[model samples]
Target chain A: DAGITQSPRHKVTETGTPVTLRCHQTENHRYMYWYRQDPGHGLRLIHYSYGVKDTDKGEVSDGYSVSRSKTEDFLLTLESATSSQTSVYFCAISESFRAEGYTFGSGTRLTVV
Target chain B: AQSVTQLDSQVPVFEEAPVELRCNYSSSVSVYLFWYVQYPNQGLQLLLKYLSGSTLVKGINGFEAEFNKSQTSFHLRKPSVHISDTAEYFCAVWNTGNQFYFGTGTSLTVIP
Candidate 1:
């Protein structure tokens, strides 16, 4: 809510398609993360970046990839969207890995047909 | 090597009723606990956090949580809940690796 902004508040795309969601932060937080919210899974980490050109996979990172080319932007791309990939995606940022907590963006709701 | 347990999937209570949501971590001798509330379509907002001192941590929206190291539990409590409090509550902990782990989440339905 603070300095974080998620692009494409809502989107609907067909299966087997590719989609990209963006998370932009004005706080220059050193750590950025991508999380997906599902009905029964709560929020699961998808990918995270510790610095520019540095990223790591999350628990559910099979269908997703992330990139951090700069300090303020983290991109989440679904190479091939599927029914199971349809969920609300949230972007969170923190100053460091040991931050007490994170500041989350409003979130992007994506639907796949 | 860290995980969280919500224990409850859903909790129903009438308006102005007291409710408690249970959260536990696995074999964690030390942890940073946090509670976040998600209302409807809004993004999650931090309710409270327990970093150190004061086992009882009070947060916004009249929500509070107690961190019990012996039990590895951090349970959220509110004396009286309102319809507005009918939302998804998540308990999270930062492990030694500095990665965050979240519980399955407890959906609180405040019946009018």
Candidate 2:
């Protein structure tokens, strides 16, 4: 929602090309997450960062990778884009896991051609 | 880890009618429940949440949810819905790690 921003709101890339989606937050929240939304699958977490340089994988991390070098930025990369990687990616930020709620960015719609 | 399951993929209702969207979760330990609504081409907005101390939770836009521990279910309800309420609804549960698990969305369509 507020304070979180995702780059490349829309992108189209050819299969086998590298794609990276960026998530930036101004809230200074320590917890950041990346999720992909797909039909019949809802939202599946790809990766998350608890702090700068501390990252962990989620349920669906096979084709995705993430890096968080700074508290304000979390980047999700697809080593080689594939047709199955096409979906809307959303970034979320929270002060803590027990925090009231997570604030999400608008999202990036990626299409693999 | 927690898992959420939404029973319906689509629910079509007439305007001003009551509606209920079903959600069931599985977790070994205690968890928090939430419902979110996403309008077309927009990010998800929180509809309501159930943490503790209350089985019935009220949320924005006249939405409410009941957490039934016995059945391990959290179902969202609205007494009377409007056209504006037509949107995709998601049910989510927060795990012990504070990670959220979501269900397949249920799209609600309000008709005249």
Candidate 3:
């Protein structure tokens, strides 16, 4: 939370419009993740970056894309925002896969109308 | 692949009472377990983690969890919970994979 920050803490967007959420970390963690939280679904991992330009899709990565050109930044982009995509999105950072735990950002609340 | 399940969706407890949140995971390989807490409209915070040895792990806010590999359970406990502990608790597992699997979460309510 202290080292990771997500931009546009709150956002309202129209359907079919592309939206991008940015996550920046000062701790220089090697791992970064994007997750979406919803009712009953908990936190679903959208995507994760292991290093610069090295990313992988998570369980729910169909409509989302991510990029990590820099170690300090990981961005999640929705191809076309939909009502189902309206949820609280969180960004987390970890030094390694077996590190202590993840440090999460405040989160971005997105509303699609 | 790894998956986590939180047995209880909600648990209501009186202040100063002891409480436990149950969690079980399904992973073929060795696993790393963790517990997280989330307040309203906030991100999840690390409560505790079980990376390797020592089955019993203590976390912040007087929270502790025990890792039972036999039953594949990692249950969180607090001898005396406070009102401030009222929040949503999540149990997660991360194997040697690309991402961590999280449970639906358990809503813990502390009554005064």
**Which segments of candidate 2 are over 4 A away from where they belong?**
none
- Could you give the DockQ of candidate 2? 0.69
Steric overlap count per candidate: 0, 1, 0
Model 1 regions more than 4 Å off: none
Give the candidate number with the greatest TM-score: 2
In what order do the candidates fall by DockQ, top score first? 1, 2, 3
- TM-score for chain B of all predictions: 0.96, 0.97, 0.97
Q: Listing every candidate in turn, what is its Cα RMSD in Å to the true structure after a full C-alpha superposition?
A: 1.3, 1.3, 1.4
lDDT (tens digit, per residue) of candidate 2 on B1-112? 5778999999999999999999998874788899999998777888999889889999999999999998899999999999999999999998667678899999999998
Q: Which tens-of-lDDT digit does each residue in A1-113 have in candidate 2? A: 77898998999999999999999999999999999999999999899899999999988999899999999999999999999999999998889866355888889999999
Which lDDT values do the candidates have, in the order given? 0.92, 0.92, 0.92
In candidate 1, residue A109 scores what lDDT? 98
Error of 3 at A73 (Å): 1.7
Cα lDDT tens digits, model 1, A4-52, are 9999999999999999999999998899999999987789999999999
Which number leads on DockQ? 1
TM of each candidate vs. truth = 0.95, 0.96, 0.95
The ten-residue window of minimal lDDT in model 2 chain B covers B92-101
The better candidate by DockQ, 1 or 2, is 1
